[model samples]
Target: MAETSDQDSKTEEPTEKKVRDALEQGNIPVSREAPIFASMAALMVILTFLIGRGVQQITLTLKGLLDDPDGFPLGAPADALNLLTVVGLEALRFLTPLLVIFAVFGLAAQLLQNAPNLVLQRIMPDLSRISPLNGWKRLFGTQGLVEFAKSMFKLASVSAVVAFVLRSSEAKAFEAMYTDPVALPEMILSIAMRIVSAICIATIVLVAIDLAWARFHWRRELRMTKQEIKDEHKQAEGDPLIKARLRSLARDRSRQRMIASAARATLVIANPTHFAIALRYKREENAAPLVVAKGMDVIALKIREVAEQNRIPVIENKALARALYEAVQVDQVIPAEFFRPVAEIIYFLQSKQAPRPEKVQ
Candidate 1:
């Protein structure tokens, strides 16, 4: 049983149908590293654009508080609350742009990883998700190990990048420290930006590796078993027995309609057994003769019955009947190339008494 189970799960590549079904179910592979990379990159951009203004604003606020200590409320609780509110508002204003930037990057990262698709199933709850076995599998299985390894690698890589940046700039940073105090803030900001740039570059490399792994892993997970492929094929093509029955029913209805249409035909040209084509012509209504009905074998026999019952002429001309049956469809004019032959037959029928019905071959 165990071997059988393994065999059933042996498929290593997903079919296109499986991938489409998985997408409909909102089961897509996601890389945790993608969001981390986007956030870090956004931070690098934000810092590059706003760090100098942010630092200068905060420094001014601090200096104002220090220089005017008496301006701050001291004892009264209401006054202290007012003072706190002002400071809180200032901090909120400073952080709001960063928060917005983070949110935009997060959204962009998710959309990049999985292009926009409406998946109603994703919002629906599944009891299977709460099962203890599934939870345990997620916590302790290969996925858990992979996640842990990724986290450790990211942490180590970022730490290594920061250390390298700091080490390389140690001389410049030390020199800045000994320079004018008035220039210290700008110098510090420059060093911080350099470190952020290095970290962003490193995170980008991790994101690329994770994206490739995620796609490969997703494809493997969506693979179908041999039985699943068979089932999907059956679903797409329909059950052969059921399809055959439907086709038989359709043919029966079509044959019945052909017989009814023969009621208005001028004559039926038949091959004596296998082929029958009913022709109609009206000089006032149409310029050419129309093939109103056609059939083969058993249907040809029925067409003969209908033609005789309606007093429609039945001419047995094997070659003409076969050609008309092969080339012309019900309600269609016989092609111009065969018009002369059909016209001659019609002229003969008009000039003579309608022939008695003959047995169909």
Candidate 2:
């Protein structure tokens, strides 16, 4: 169980590391609805242009028929068929450009908003697909209120534009009907263009406002509290208890390895209380001394057992051992200050000389 806990701790670090990496990337979340408003604005502009052009064309055709009905031959079946075909084709042509413009603008709006790449999940049906609770919540929500206001604003703006255009053109439009048929179509076309342009401009303003609102709401929804981030990390990885157990098991395994290595040490230096440091050196093979093992209390006892079993020398140096344990870590060279004393110990052992107990002078 301890071994498993140790393994878990080692694995947990990578998961946390990945979360940290993602946070560092600093991706800003966006609302899905913002693009819809932008796209609608683009579509409205296209519709305005197309409708204005179509109305002008239709007005010209009407003027041509009214000015000289015999010359245009509107009564013949073949001529009527050809005229209908031309009008139908012209309407399609007008609408085609608008369709293409809307499609491109919609795509661009989505891209600029940094929406997530299209995924199957968005299109897939789920239990919430038909939820009346969600419907009611949306209908009575802030978004619904915004939509209602937008509708009223559009209605009022269009009504005002129509009233102004009709009042200004009523005299001229009436005079043109009796004076010249061509002038009649021109007047009608002029009125239609003014109305369409007003509607388009109004739509653009509303959509821009809606897009801004959507962005603000999206940011609010994505804001994460510090505690929430922590909880998410824990869920993605595991709890602290499991991580602590794993670390303990790892330390135990490391201690076992250290003890096994200490058996080959030339000497064990002890603080005579808590610390123990074992040093090993090989002349002609190593340029400097190496620490084979280090520990405290129970770990110190374990180091002693390994040294004694291997017939390695043991020395009690309260100050030097503690300093070595504190200043140097395992598999590191002893500090320069302790080098002379440590060298003398090594020299005596290698030369088969008697052990000397000399205090630093």
Candidate 3:
């Protein structure tokens, strides 16, 4: 077990990319407490605000039924159907608000519990879910044990709150048993309300703690190993070896273009065997001499060979060659400071006067 954990286990937090990908697959932190809390809260709302109205409506309905036994619209099929529709509409009008509010509360709780993410992957079937071994593990594993413990805790807490409420109101309840029928309902309702309110308040506290625990557990579950992080990074950026090869190919192609451009240069400035820069000036095209080709080492030698084949003059100027190679790029005009020196080289080549060529070292 320890060796297995050491292989690809994670101790670090999940990266943002990992979290986002998980979300896309419908993996998100969700607490069971959210649904329970929403249900309890909705129940509380109904008990506090709608219960009296519901009781009054029921009372009216019963009274209406009893008040005219003969006139009750069950005389014929048409009359009965009409009466049922009227009663159904009336009930729906009163009850729809409560139902809608309950639904809203539950939906709001879920939205607040998890970032809103919709993914079709969640509905995809998984064979593992139906496997007997997986079922057994779900029922007997650590998560199962925790759930059992939580259920027991909730049951005990609610039972205790109910017992406390009843015990506190025991005397009133006993007295109400012998009192007038009209006041008995009020007394019973009072005790029931107290019990429900206490239970809801207690459960709210439990739900809050459960929600925090669920979020922490989910984050831990999503943690990634070092290898996983590295793989994800590579997938996002690209493979390093492939990228290096591509760069080498690009540089070689660029070098070929530069060497070819050297054939049209007015002259080649050589830094012995270390560097070479080919200068080209077209009075109609450029305001200053342009470094048509530039290269180092073997590429410098190729640039010189190209110049020799084109009968372009080769001058030895170590400083100017190095400066041009370092400061200017192929096809770019020389800087203002190097203008006079490069212009003299261009002028010497254009004059058709063969200056003494520097010997190849």
The local distance difference test score of each candidate is 0.83, 0.71, 0.83
Report clashes for each candidate as comma-separated counts: 2, 2, 0
Error of 1 at 38 (Å): 2.5
The regions of model 2 sitting more than 4 angstroms off are 1-95, 105-116, 223-227, 233-239, 350-361
Write candidate 1's Cα lDDT for 1-361 as tens digits: 6845674695856778888888878899898898988888888878888767876787788789889988996789988898788788878878888899999999999998888888878878899899999988787776778778888888998899889988988898789867998898777777788888888888888888888888887886677778788778889999888999999999888878888998899888999889988888999978999888899998898888898898888888888888888899888899998899888877776666556643333
lDDT (tens digit, per residue) of candidate 2 on 97-183: 777877887777667766445455556777675799878757777667766776787789779878887888789777885786756
Rank by lDDT, highest first: 1, 3, 2
Worst 10 residues of 2 by lDDT: 6-15
Q: Which pairs of residues have clashing backbones in candidate 3? A: none
TM-score for each predicted model, relative to the true structure? 0.74, 0.70, 0.90
**Maximum-TM-score candidate:** 3
User: What's the residue-level lDDT of 345 in candidate 3?
Assistant: 70
Residue 161 Cα positional deviation in candidate 3, in Å, after optimal superposition: 0.7
lDDT of 1 at 68: 96
